[model samples]
Target: MSSSTPADAGSKPAGPLSGILVVSIDQAVAGPLCAMRLADAGARVIKIEAEDGDRARDYDKAMGSTSAAFGWLNRGKESVVLNLKDPGDLALVKAMLARADVFVQNLAPGASDRLGLGAAQLTKEFPRLVVVDIMGYGRETSYASKRAYDMLVQSESGICAVTGTPEVPSKVGISIADIGTGTNAYAAVLEALFERERTGRGQALEVAMFDCMAEWMSLPLLHFDYMGVETARFGLSHASVYPYRPYHCADGDIVVSIQSTAEWVRFCTTVLRSPEFAKDPRFIDNWARVQNRDALDEAIHAVFTPHSCAEMIERLEAGQIAWARVSTLHDLSVHPALRRIPVEMPGGEMAEMPRPAGRIVASGAKVPPLGADTARIRAEFAGAAPAAAKQA
Candidate 1:
């Protein structure tokens, strides 16, 4: 892997992807997140934005100067403003892609093809360049032209059908559709990179938000299709599992899980202190317990309602039962297990955020401001010879 400029030598943090160049024409959560993960792995990512900049930058001013979404997802990348509609700007992007190891874009449907920046064209022009197109749906599907947002995709994919209370369906509180698609896009890029190493060729790839969410809905879909069973919505509880819901203690609520008969027996004897109840015909097996959940809950509440959460937790630990507190946002803020890393906001303010799993990023990586590197990047790539393509 190599970069277009020697400036990559000491500027990027040392990591597995050091010296690899990524050119991204991206905006919003899914696209920006995929580019950010590449940057995190030591790729030199140049984010090309429109004149007004990524819409997410204007979503909110929660970071004092930048939007919280933009601040969190655009760290350690260069920003270049470009109007792809302009021939010169479009040529400049092509020049950058010529030297880039990867090209990622999440433009609206047909927009990339119109600009001649679509995956097929790019892969044909630069055979060694891995191109990724992120979209709302697969281009072959009828919904390809339909607009997709996090909440809309969630509702369309039936994710809301299995969430929230029985009386109402609800989309997830967070942007799960976007987050999952971003992570999947990142994984797909990594896989493409690995394949390039073996095949000596690069390929075009597509990751659709609807496709990701539909795959996540597999279990529910399977149940409905094969068993003639509709998975019911159980707020804060497991839909198919018995004794896997939270119970109110005297002070707070704690969730308990019993996945096996042994655990159920132990829970009855040690946690509930009622060994005979474990033998009751109404709650002998998981299916039976699930059917008699109301009565089971009544029995469990009889013992837990008079005890504090700490008291019940102690019994749970003694019985080796899996349990967790129903923690609120405040509880999470002060959580003991949460690991944080320091990052510089676009305005130069230092902020601490939760660390991503399975990666160790050095502190103080700065999120780029809009068009922060436009002048420098233009001077570097304008009329400059393309870097030699990598060989397999």
Candidate 2:
């Protein structure tokens, strides 16, 4: 393992994405995330925005003024506010696309085509330009034009159906749908780029949040299809295991899972101090224990009531039982393995944000301010830019 920290490591002379130039007509999470990942790996990203800017800028009041999401994902890119409806700005965007290795967009449904930026148009004009489109739903579907948000997509894709307690299905607290789409788009774009090198032709990539969420919901979807029954939510409890849920240890609750019969036997003997309980016919196997869950829970609760959380954890650890504290969001921030990067915002203030995981990089650069490079880009590409292509 390389002992070099990404923070202390100097910029590499050769980056994995060094020669790439990406143009993005994007706003919000999915598009920004894709562009940011490219930029982080040393691609020169031009984030084309509407005059009003990405709505994510005003998402929250935390961190003084800048939204945390924007700060996290918009770094290391040149932002340019453009009016796509205006011929001049549209022409400028096309000029960038002419020279770009990649062009990505997540505009409102049909808006990209209206502005002549859809995959069909770009693929025709720039044969070798990788075009990636991010949408709420796939274009082939009837509901393609509906306004789609992360929470709505999660609900629509049936992710909420299997998550949370049985009484109330809840959307994931984070923007999981958007992130999923972004991640899928990123991987798809990389794959297309690789294939492009071989074929000498770039391909178009499309990813929708609904489609991504549906793919993620496959496990539950398959289970329901096979069994012809919906899985009931157990509120953090295992559906087929007893004494495999959170239990109060004197004051606070701790989660533990006793999966195998041998682990259950050890828990009964070492933790519960009732070795005979393991051999009780009613609680012998997982199925039987699950059937008698009420009684099993009561027995385990009684054993836990007398012990402190630390004592219970120590005993559980010694018994080789899997256990963990019910961690809150705050606990996640201070987790032992958590990595943070200091973000320097436009206002010259720095804040530590969680670093992106699984990012392979050989170079680094800072983000440009909104429209910081608009003049330079316009001047550089003005003469070479094709006239505004008529919309179909």
Candidate 3:
């Protein structure tokens, strides 16, 4: 594992966003994750937290003394503690925003407005600043003020209805709502930055968690709205696609997907060793197979249940079928394709974790401790601070 201190003002990694400055009043998963992406792209991210720090910091001490969530989402950024209710501290934030290229926050709905750090207010004051407001629901809706945690938003968006087994609706095991919202926020920030380059003016943007989950639920929503098809929860199996789910083998399970006629033919002939099955009238096409899924499952189980995972895998490879083992956490920990990067935790210990897709993060980037850069930042912006409560 590699290691480095939290980046100082004078030093930043070389990337497309090398010269960009990001000031974020962010907490928890969504906001921090968005800021981290900017930091990964070499933007200098200054994370302004409350005096007690981000609540995620106390979620768990899974990574030494730092919470796993905080450690995972806060590398390569400076941490500054501030009480927004304090006039002096609020002035400091305003000073930082004056020079920042982007500002991101995921405070409770209307909290930013109370603090005078709302997107509308910020963009008006800083014409060149791209401002992003991450919210649980769109401000235009009645649910705007409703509290929305990851599971709440997932349930509200009907993601739970199409997940889990047939008997039980379940929220995703991971925080998909928060993750998707943060990712969308990051993309919006990037778009705003590009637009700023073209127009020499930045824009205010809103990214709602409910909106993100709704977009992800498009397939199920469309089916129900247009075709009167309520997507069923199939557990490990797909609701609409036949033979696109896992089958129990001698030792474990392996998922197989036959998406086209050619793949179906190859699967029947090579993997199942039954070319005749490919021409069966009840399973000739995808729609037909879906209708006769019970018989299809029985037939597939008859073959797979008698074979070992390795044997089926070899046959699957021979047939060029898309397949995967139902991998556990242990399996993924040792996965050959999993790429890891070294990160320096808040306590100065080096740890390795999976790398982000499509981004080259600096290996030695460090996660800042609570208020690690507070004093320095306070001093740097002291002289520039406007009159207390004037703009705030």
Per-candidate TM equals 0.96, 0.87, 0.95
lDDT of 1 by residue, 1-392 (tens): 55644343365567888778899988889999999998888888999999999999989988887988998899989999999999999888877887888899998898999999888878877888889999999999999988889999999999999999999999999999999999999999999999988987789999999999999999989989999889999899887789999999999899999999999999999999999989999999998998798899999999999999999999999999999988889999899998988888888888887898989887768898899899988987888465344222
- Top candidate, metric TM-score: 1
- Against the reference, the lDDT scores of all candidates come to 0.89, 0.79, 0.88
**Residues 56-174, candidate 2, lDDT per residue (tens digit)?**
87787465556777877888777777888899888788777777878888988998888778899889888888899899998999989998989999999987877789898888879
lDDT per residue (tens digit) for residues 1-392 in model 3: 00122335545667778778888988889999999999999888899988889999989988896988999999989999999999989988888777678889998889999999988878778787789999999999999998789999999999999999999999999999999999999999999988888988888999999999999999889989999989989998887777899999999999999999999999999998999989999899997998898899999999999899999999999999999988899999999999999998899878887899998787678999999999988887776744222222
Listed per model in order, the count of residue pairs whose N, CA or C atoms clash below 3 Å is 0, 1, 0
Candidate 2: Cα lDDT at 106 = 91
User: Candidate 3, residue 204: CA error in Å?
Assistant: 0.8
**What lDDT would candidate 1 get against the real structure?**
0.89
TM-score-sorted candidate list, best first = 1, 3, 2
**For model 2, where is the 10-residue window of minimal lDDT?**
1-10
TM-score-better candidate, 1 vs 3: 1
